[model samples]
Target chain A: MMTYDALSFLLKAVIRFGLYMLLCISIYMLSASLRKKSPVLIVPTFLSVLISGSMFVLYDARGQKSGLDHRAAVRWLCEKPILFTILLFAAAAVLLTYVTFREAHLRRTVPDRSSIKESIDHLPTGLCFYAENGRVMLVNHRMNQLCHIILGRDLQNAALVWDDLCGGSIQPDIMRLSTDSQPRFRLSDGTVWSFSRTQLPDMFQITAVDITQLHNLAQELEQKNIALEELYQRLKVYETDVEVLTRTRERLETKIGIHSELGQTLLATRSYLLDNNENKTIPVEAWKRSIALLRQNIVENAEQFTLQTLIQTATAFGISVEVTGQMPEQKDVEKLFLEAATEALTNAVRHADAKKLHISLTETADTYRICFQNDGKMPETQVTEGGGLGSLRRKAETAGGSMQIDCHPEYSLTISMPKGGTENI
Target chain B: MTRVLIVEDAPMDRQLLELYVKQSGQYELVPSVESAAFAEFCCRTTRVDLILMDVCTSLYANGIDAAEKIKQNFPQIKIIIITGQPECSFIERARKAGVDSFWYKTETAESILHVMERTMAGETVYPESTPPLQFGYITSDELTARELEVLREVVAGESDAAIAEKLYMSLRTVKGHIQSMRDKTGFRNRTELAVRARDCGLIIVDKETE
Candidate 1:
């Protein structure tokens, strides 16, 4: 019987040892649950309580079977079951308080990530965050507002909205749109949304701003610049007209001077011949010839100095002249031809000491040309434009024509003008 | 007989002068040339007592310039400078060139024969004033002596610096004179004033100088 009692005691000791280990395991599990604030603490606490109560029942059965000495030795474990359970509850409460303080400190140390997300969402500019997996992870309030304007709905289905904006399905491998490709979205309200994406390893951020007003202003400025360019072109034309008018005034002044000088000369000659009429020594034939010559010069000089007149005048100066073709009919052209002829004759006789002059008037499809050549002694080198030739060149150029001098074989003057006189100048 | 050298370019003018000299009965015609340089050469080679010089020779040697050279070399020979140009400045320049007499070809009250006789008799014949030839709004008398010289250079197509060098004036002075001329005549540019001055026959220069 005693042996049977000893075996039962050994069995109680093994049960108490297992219950002690289980209680330690329950406390460890409770501490872990307190850190997480999980509901799993209740299972560990119930198991500890049931095991402690069974230990109490096992202690009472051992006390009944054993003497008082053995009962006294085990009373500390058996009699204080409620207190131990209360102590265990107190330990759990302390752990819970410690965990609550730790959680409060942690909350104070780190900011809430959701608040950052909410801050970006409330920004005025459109913002969107894309995950590495190609999902639309976060969208700001402006982005949502943009979607509402474009799609007539909120961005709860942001992936579909993004696909619609892209005009195709999103590729799975691409985290976000390429940075080089700045895609733009034009909404129904005529607001232009230009997007730029910033990429990171795990995600990318897209920003959009409205540039519609700026774009319209730029277009308007471009049109104004074009108009300004056209005005500049017109000013160039007016400048050329001013140059031509200036030259014409000079030519007219020159004509007036020539006329005045010629009148004075003719009057002087008439008075000389008349004053010398009664001289006994002067021959009558010489007198008659001088009167005839004076009268012819007056008639010729008075009635538009023609090419023939130029020839006669040069011939009178002891220079031989050969002329071809008829003079131009236009009064202005005739005057120009006469002036040029006279000037050439003067240059030939005086400057070049020319004995023979050859003149030709040729008409082409668009031009009237007067060519005067003299067998004069010209310089071996190129001649600078003198006052006479310079004036002729300026007049010819102003009239939308040109004049050239050739001094190789002989001294020659070529004056070419438009037949119709249709020049911008 | 006083030998005469006629340096007129026109055949008619030359013939008229020939008749006047022959009619004078005391003068003999030397075989003449048109240019003044040749006239100078003739005076040097042959005996010439009087020279009737046309101011506008239309040759490299202007009559005034040729007269100046001839008078310098042959101071004993008398020269009568004649021109249709009515510029008072031309007479002054001819006087400076040491001409013996001055006569206006068309406007002179005295005949060429009368000027030649007076010049031979050792009288410095000069008109009181040049004939009045109207230009734009003024006559050639409106310009000063220096201004006339400057105008001739301008008509010769000389640049301002070249004109200044030829006239012994600063470039600024030359430009200032041109600007004043433009303002006086109401001409727009130098070319207009110059071209008009040349056409008026106010001042004659050698074409080679151009």
Candidate 2:
């Protein structure tokens, strides 16, 4: 009976000890779960396990029964139930370390969503975001700045409704579309916009971009092309004028050809007569008459050529020639003077609408001055349109001269040409 | 009157030179020899006072080559180099060959007469616009007349035949002169000689074409 009672008590103690260990293990697991933000209370957990072990040892030693006080069996137990909790916890900690290492490595290599958003915010163009319910979700800094310029207020997409956020009603058709719909809009300021939509299950993502500068640049380029085509037409006209002049020159050259031919023929006849010496009187009289006729013909031809040349030059362009000061004797001086004067006149007639034109020419021994003026408003000076006049000015400078424009409500162009032209031919 | 030996390969240019020389009245004509071999014979026996050498004497060969050979045998022989080229390299080569004077055919008649008078006075006369001394063409004056001739040939981008025709001489004579010039100036080819001459300012290569 004594041994039986001892065995039963020992068994009860064993049960109690097992229940205590289970409770202790449950508490530790709970604490570990709660303490996820910090490291698990390792020191306290180890202390609890130690205390539990000491209590189990004391209780088992005191309550010596067959089940609970089985010292011979429990003393060398490498597989204790309470110790299993520690082993499980150690395995979990190792798994957590490996997971954390891999996550840290990925974070280092790949840019995160927030980091990409930050860069997009720094962009120069406007950018906006809309949510699943078509509400304003998030917008970058660039989009925020543009909102002031466009809507005249700070935009906070607290409510993603276009009418509420934009201070005006959204396009009804565009508002009704799903978040995944990409739509485009052109604003009153000539700004063109493109909105890209992305579907995120419950939420819609819309990125609105402004393409106004690109549209304006395209329009400017189209205008430039039109101007270039007009310029090409003008060049064709100039080519025709050159061809006409060349033909006229050829026609004039034909008449001069006969004079030289006649002179040569008369000389040949004279040589024949001189060799024979038998027919002298007729040959001498013919030679003298031919000589006198040649001189008369030469003088008349020169007078005719000069008269024709003057008429052609005066009537060539829309300009009426007025006698100015004495021009230079240099062969190319007239060419230079006419070119400079023509450019000034063309500008006034074509652009300024000036009907009255006055040109004054004066010359010193070493200098030539020309003043061409019109009571016309100066055209708005554009560098692109100013290239022709600029080239003329450069030509004058090359001839050791100067050019200036005096612009009042009226226009006056003054050009100066030096005597012995520019040194840098 | 100084008895000048006329050495030229072309009939027309030779005649033109004779006319000019006769008009000057400072020089008397001797037998005109056209080849280096004949020039050597004239040099050996004739009482020649001056040698009016056309660089184109070899008929498309270098007159400088023959002049150099003649100079070797008789150092005191007064050599007058006449050419159509205006190059410093040629002037330098002629100076090295110990030529007495140089003249260009395209100069005004008065300049030609002046060069003659100066040369007869036993003064070393060279063109005012001689090339600079870089590839060492100038012994004293910047350029000699002969160097200018070679430079002009090179600048014209002419073959020996073209140069002979332009200067009224033979192709062989021009070639010989160019070869001899190359040997003296250490130039690789006629082109190099021309470029170096222009760079050295022997002739206004840019001005000649214009």
Candidate 3:
């Protein structure tokens, strides 16, 4: 009887534990359904709660009726074994279905480990995180592909890959973006990428961003700048042409005016000459004016003022210019020499009434010297700097040269200029 | 006989044209004037059959402008625009002005009387081209348009830097043009090049100074 009583207590304890497990599972399902707002879990939770509550109530009534005798409850369960076995089988089936549905729901909603890795692998840019020991922590597919191209292997050590990129020992297919300190490279397909690194708390992160479009735009802009420069040059040439045409028109107008004046004067002379009346005179003033105009036109139309022209003019004035030694090959020096000779010719003719003018040219290592001496009378008084001499002196000084006039012991003028020093003039 | 009116600023050219009209014997000479301003009035008062107009007339009257007005008013009166200056846009302006014939005083090989006769004979007479002038070792026609532009600035006494700035070219480019011109002309220096160019009347600058 004691053994029966012990067995009854054990069975009661086993039943209570099973009921407690059912109650806990039901409550958990209820709370989980409420949180997720899942109507599918509601039926399963209600069934579990009802079964556990009814069983608990039946056991308690049997225990109270028998006055703490566990043997009566044992005998009660033994008599309805078939009914208890059916109920137990039904509860086990319900629990199995609920557990299976819950597992499927979790699989559909939650991301798996492989899926998370797939997302990181498909990123556009190259990304890698590495530890201090050069161990690759997290590397994407793009980075591994870049490593294969650069290092000829999959990414094992990200720090080594970064070192290879920075060392600039890559293949000819890769070109450096610029001479700047930034690490940027251009691939063979015209794709430009800029690589950069950042230090995290315990790791290092390296990234390569695509910059092809910006590089192409910069190249296009450079080409346009060159074209604009060419267009600006063309416009400038047109402007200068217009300016020249305008000036030419003005000169033609002046010439036409002079020609018209001369024609009018000729006509006046003809009319005066053909006049049959004795009241008309010769019009001497008009004739003189016409002659003056003709002379002015002739002088204006004379050859340009060069050394040859100057010499011809001096000869026309009954003064012969005797040039000795070779003239300097430099244009500016030759021009200055001719100017001084002209001044000497004018001074000799106007002031001293000379006939022969001699010009001597000589060159030293660094200076060109020209001396103008005329066979004219000596100056009666000390010669001062007048308009012509003063102007010549100013010009000479401006050209980085010097001019001197010696009045005594025959009149001679010497001017010296340094070679290659008169370019601005 | 065609009655003609002469409009010329210069008395010599006007007298010459008057003599040509009188000597033609086929044309009758009307009154002559010194300016194109009197051309329309002369046409209005007289029975004018044709008009000989000069491009640059006295009183600042442009003959082309006057000719355009006359053509609009009396299109029947045949007009011939004559000019001595080759640098001016007289030919183009005269054509746009609807003048009957154009004659260059110095450049045209044909006589002005021939041009007038052609116009009276219902022929549109125009020269093939302007007369080519000798400039240094090359003719004016031989110079490229760009080279001519640079030459004009050089003749204007502009420095290389100034010319480069004005023409929107580099300093080296201006120097290059000058050097090319020198090589073509075989001139010794820039001063000689400028002086010879001016003397040849290829490029005329303002003031006409040395």
Candidate 4:
């Protein structure tokens, strides 16, 4: 009898230890489910903890009322069919919690197909992959939006859209398509999108990149190039003008030299002529050299002076040239008239000793006439045309002009030239 | 006696100018040099009352340029710019440089000694007009100013279109001017006209020799 009682105590202690272990396992599963936020594991773990705790509490209370120990109460509860059923339920709850926890862990670690699809749909650049049969394999949100805006429909066949874009058959008001080999589209919002396609193993990929800033920069560069070219042309013209100005200045210098030489020669001659002493302050050889130099200068530069220059020269030589009319505007006709005036001025100064000369210019519809008269002594004899006058007459006649000498009537010389006289020359 | 400095490249011309200065009895001869480049240095080192500067000198030094620099530093001294070349724009450049006088070596009627005396006596002597240069059958003064501009480009061997673009004239206007020049000068063609203009020293296109 004492041996039976000891075996009963030992059995009670083993069952009590097993019940405590089951209760601890259920509480641990409940805390783990709450931390993981796994609803599937939470319900089973909560129920398992409740069932084990209530069985232990009911047996301990009944044992204390019957004046039995805790180990004895656990042994008595283990013998009941309800305790076995609760144990089976606890085992099933634990299996269910473990299975639920493993599934939650896999869901947190690995990405699924739907999440990958969602990620691709939100990319910035438009991307589309289409098979040879025109079936769209994958397309991003940007690509779909672009297709809707361009084609007025949802993206269905990327190949057909690419073909349409390449054919340049899209609505031009909505998007401006470039005509170059590479496809580029300019939208109504002033956004430039550069589109390109690449061939994959069994499909084609199309990408649209935003290149508005680059496009604008390129256009600005082109305009600046044109402006630079214009500036270069203007600079070239300025260089040419400088060259011309330099040449003109050189010619002016030459004219100044001639004037200085002539003035000096005249002064020297006048001084030599005035010195009447036996021992002349200026020698005759000096006079001869000055005269020879003057003659040579006159021969070389006889026709070099312009009308203004001739008038200025006459003024310098103490002869005033008074004009009554404007000179001819035609270059050739004016040249002939100047030649006549030159000859007339020389004659008036050398022979007639003129103080003032008068020039009258008159123009008609078909002809221009100029008359030269001086305030000097009238020719006592009939005027004879010398080398100067003869050469003037020939030049006048060559240009279809006529020269007349009227010495009897105040020694006036008139030259008449037909308009367009340069043609004849 | 006024101290005069002679700056001429040609040995004969320099000797003649030196002789004239020595014989004047009124001016002292400073040591002469071949280039105007040393004029400013001579002025700095010694007493200089006058400078007879030639347009072109040895070592490619331009007299007008050097004279301009010297006048800027020493405005009290008198300078007479002289040149034998007819195509250089030295007279105007000399006047702009504030030189006292200008003398054309080949075309001057008065002696160099007289020009020096006048310059020393506070006179700024310059020629009144250039000697007329003959271009083909006509003188340079016979052509209009516009025609001369076109002729310069022609002498430089520029094409008619290029000349028109540079002068800002229409091609047809350039052609008309060339034709008018040819008619006035009685040249058979443009080549003959350009060659004659270049040969006669009417318009020099090459700056290398200037």
For candidate 2, give the lDDT of residue A398.
72
What clash pairs does model 1 have?
A121-A141, A350-B58
* Interface RMSD after interface superposition, model 4: 21.1
* Candidate 2 per-residue C-alpha lDDT over B50-147 given as tens digits, one digit per residue, 9 for 90 to 100: 77776643312355655777788777777778765444456667788888888765454446557767777888877765423456443414334554
Residues A197-286 of candidate 2 have per-residue lDDT tens digits of 456666655456776676568779999999979976764584446434433442344334434545655776776777866653344433
Stretches of candidate 2 above 4 Å error? A1-93, A105-125, A129-134, A154-227, A262-425, B1-210
Residue-level lDDT tens digits of model 4 in A294-348: 4542221112335675566566445688888888888777766775676677667
lDDT leader: 4
Q: Where does the lowest 10-residue lDDT sum fall in candidate 2 chain A?
A: A299-308
Which segments of candidate 3 are over 4 A away from where they belong?
A1-116, A179-181, A260-425, B1-210
Give each candidate's interface RMSD in Å. Answer: 11.6, 28.5, 19.6, 21.1
Clashing pairs in 4: A254-B130, A255-B129, A255-B130, A256-B127, A256-B129, A256-B130
Say what the interface RMSD of candidate 3 is.
19.6
True C-alpha contacts between chains kept, each model in order: 0.00, 0.00, 0.00, 0.02
Candidate of highest TM-score: 1
TM-score for candidate 3, please give it. Answer: 0.34
**DockQ score of candidate 4?**
0.03
Cα shift from native, residue B131, model 2 (Å): 34
Q: Candidate 1 or 3, higher lDDT?
A: 3
Global lDDT of each model? Answer: 0.66, 0.56, 0.70, 0.72
Of candidate 3 chain A, the 10-residue stretch with the lowest lDDT total is: A296-305
lDDT of 1 by residue, A1-425 (tens): 12213345666466455555555655665565565564544454545545554554555465466564255535544455445644644554455455445555655665578767867878878988877555788888898777666556666654455555555433233223222346565555666666666786788777777777875687699999999789768645744464344334433443454355456556666766778755424344344434544454321111333566445545544667798987777665666676677667756655676788788999888888999988878766677886657867876787788999877666678999887674332
Q: Which of the CAPRI classes, incorrect, acceptable, medium or high, describes model 3?
A: incorrect
lDDT of 3 by residue, A1-425 (tens): 13212347667667666766766766676676666655566666667677776665555555455654356554565356545634763684486467548847875887677876887889999889999878998889888877676556677877777877777477667777653434788887778888888999999998977889987898899999999899768755854575455345544654575566567667766877787557766656445544544544232221334566556645643568888788888877776676566567667766776778888889999989988887878888888887557867876788899989887677778888888886534
